[model samples]
Target: MLLAASTQRTIGLVILAIVVLGGIVYIYFNIRSARNEVGSEIELASNRKPYLSDEDLEGKKLDLALGSSLVLLTIVAITLPLYWLGEPGRHEGRDLDTWRISTNRGEEIYLEGAQCVNCHGPEGAGGVVNTAITSSSGEFVAQVNWKAPALNTLMSRHTEDEILHVLNYGRNGVMPAWGSGGGGPLTDQQLEEIIFYLRSVQISEDEIRSQVDSGVEAGAKALILETSDEAWAVEVRAAEAAQADAAMAVRLLGRADFDFECSDDASECLALDEANARLTAANEAAVEPLDAAVSTWFDQVSAAKATADALVIEADPSLADEGNEDDLRAAALEILSTLDAFEGQEAYLQWGEILFSNTAAAGTYSCARCHTYGWSFDGASDYVLEENGRDGPIPELADGYVTAGGFFGPNLTGGSTLSQFETAIGQSAFITRGQAIGQTYGRGGSGGNGQMPGFGALTEANPVGPGMGPGSGIVFEYPALLTDEQIDAIVAFERTL
Candidate 1:
């Protein structure tokens, strides 16, 4: 328990008062007794009288002085141990205070100084930033909102040194250099503080799993809509239009009325409430048709899996209810294979392609952000330009993407990936466990400078601390960003490209 500053000050003052009062009383009595002495400003007279004889001074008075010294010694002995016992706790609390202060300062830099929140969102829940794409010759492409990945689970995916490396040297042109080492403004210490702030905002493991699942589900739904019958697609589009309209109505009302949530029950507040209600209903309506389409797609996938049980790990039927993720993933991969997903066939390529360039998490879980040029700026979507009445802005690629013909990362088109790995499993493994800063990979694939990120669980040694040996450091297992089945699909798509 910590005392308030005022309370502590009051206590300190009371102790000071007691000590000063005691000293004043002692001096007053001593001075008052001095008047009775025969000497008055005459040092010779007092010196002439010899000190008290041994008989008078060396008995009770001497014993009392010795006893007082012994008592003080005892107090010191007791107090020193007590103070020593509390020292560790005191220092721990101080360290905690220092960490809190540093974290707050880092948060300030992230928001105001660095303005990372402009793209990464408040508290790192993820957001989008408007950026213009450019062709090789510097011709302007459409202005698009690029998805910035969430930092709440960053610690789960990256080690401290790895994150610091990125901070010092920003990711693929999207994220700019922040540290002075990369010719940016912030100092190394300040970047470390930003990382400290990131640590403070990390979400739970369950939250990470849910986020990954949601992304996959969204991509799966998009694939379903793309392949669905015309009636199904029309219904989905109509519901989406209605949802968008309701949301727009609410926004327009909110802009006019202002602060309806905290205001009194006025006319505008009632109108805002009605708009919100309509939005909620429309949102549900929109979800219904999309969910139906996705359900049908899942049913087809399930039927395929049932027929191809022997192709993969055919576990006991009873184990199906055990919720074993590995088993389920294995089954899913087998089903995809049965649908000819791994053979670079177009029939299954659409689903794999959707997974490869998934926009969920701003394509954080997908390969496109690193592998495809201008992917972040909606390079393929001309509607964004045409919708805004800006015409004739040529895309760098006449086609949507060069697939895995990489930009920030290496190109994987024209059977490069196939040549890199002898088998699909090896390629999948390499993609799942990304290259470390100086770790080697593949045939002639020298350890990259932290280029590709591991989408699956990755184990790396903790940076050796002072007095620690190479293999003695702690090992950290970064959480998987994508599931095995999802990763396999992306790998399959790359093979096709």
Candidate 2:
């Protein structure tokens, strides 16, 4: 009975399978007919090619599947290593904290612990890299010099904002902009972190002040030695005497006695000749004293210069050290401050003023041109006064304005007013040369844009401005223009503005 039941079950299963197979066959035939019609329509296209046979299609599909799998495997292999390498866990070399921070790309963009040590010397002291730098005095003085300014003093000398500006804009063409303007290779957060790091390492103000005092003392001693140099004094006196003698001789020669034969009257000529003879005698007498004075002065200047050179050599190493940078800067400030103590010492003011005024005059406009009393001409100002006498319009001063070119000039009323006498005689030399007189002074010509001409050279726009001679429209350029000394003096006075 069991064998008979098994046979019956098998027969039923076979019948069910047959029905399913028949349905599948019907559906496959109908799909094939539809595909044929579609294939024919597609083949009518101008660019259509012959369709692949079943065997060809199967081989192509096999190849595609293998290629796709290989590609996917390759991508996975590449990404896995990259992800692993970038992971913080894989970083093993430096100060973990610094490494984490630097690699973070979130807070700051700096090298991690060991990396920092590699470029920046230990203790965050700066190291030399091949970089072009500009001097604070606006001269292209040095390039890729191994002498790197220490970074430790940056905090004491500059505010955070100012520091950011310097980092972003760079200095003296030597320092490359390292912030946003420098392509923002790092995020803003990274810059701030670096700033924080710098702040953490800054020397105290007291230390800076002390160093400055020492520098000033050294400078003062040098100055005294210069002033007391008898030999230099003698040379200067001699030069002065010679110059005076030459002038007097020329004057005497100009008299009636020296008149040209073109003169119409012999009596006038005779009278002139007599006058000339008397003048010549007087000049000869004056020559001796003038020569003596000039000789003495030159000798004094030479001796003083030598003393100054020696003092500078001694002071330079001390001033340049990261430990003493504050003091050096302070010394410079102190020197500037002393200008007020020596009120009648026009020379000091003249020197300072030339640096200040030329920085502004080298550009198109200055802080004073717009802000008036609100801004100081020596690049110092506290308030931005309004056009209405209280609050001023927003200043459009860009980084370039402060260091290269500006639309306005600075005001110097906060300190001391420059006497016209000093301006006339002190800054004359600088004015005549048309050279930008300070580290921040701009180039003279309008930078490439024809609409604006440079202030240094003769331009159609500025025919009579500083450095330019009288306009061509004038009958004759002044035969003998103001001397450079006179121009420098004028610039000095302008600084007192």
Q: Which residue ranges in model 1 land beyond 4 Å of their true spot?
A: 1-58, 234-289, 299-309, 312-352, 387-390, 458-478
Q: List, residue by residue over 1-497, the lDDT tens digit for candidate 2.
A: 23443555565456555645765797699668764223334334667766776567668797799779867865664565445443433332333465345335322334562143344444445554444323345543222323233454444323344556656765434345666766635445566667645544554445434443343333333333334345444444454455445444444454434554424354544554555565555446545554565455345433433343344446565665668644553343333333342223344443333333222211111212232321222222211221113232224321212321222222334332243123232223223323221222132222221211111222122222112234423221111122222233334334444
lDDT of 1 by residue, 266-377 (tens): 5544555555565556556657787876676666544544444434444456435556655655554534533353332343445567767767656666677778876766
TM-score of 2: 0.27
What's the TM for model 1? 0.68
The window of 10 residues in a row where model 2 has the poorest summed lDDT is 359-368
TM-scores of the candidates in the order shown: 0.68, 0.27
Clash count in backbone of candidate 1: 0
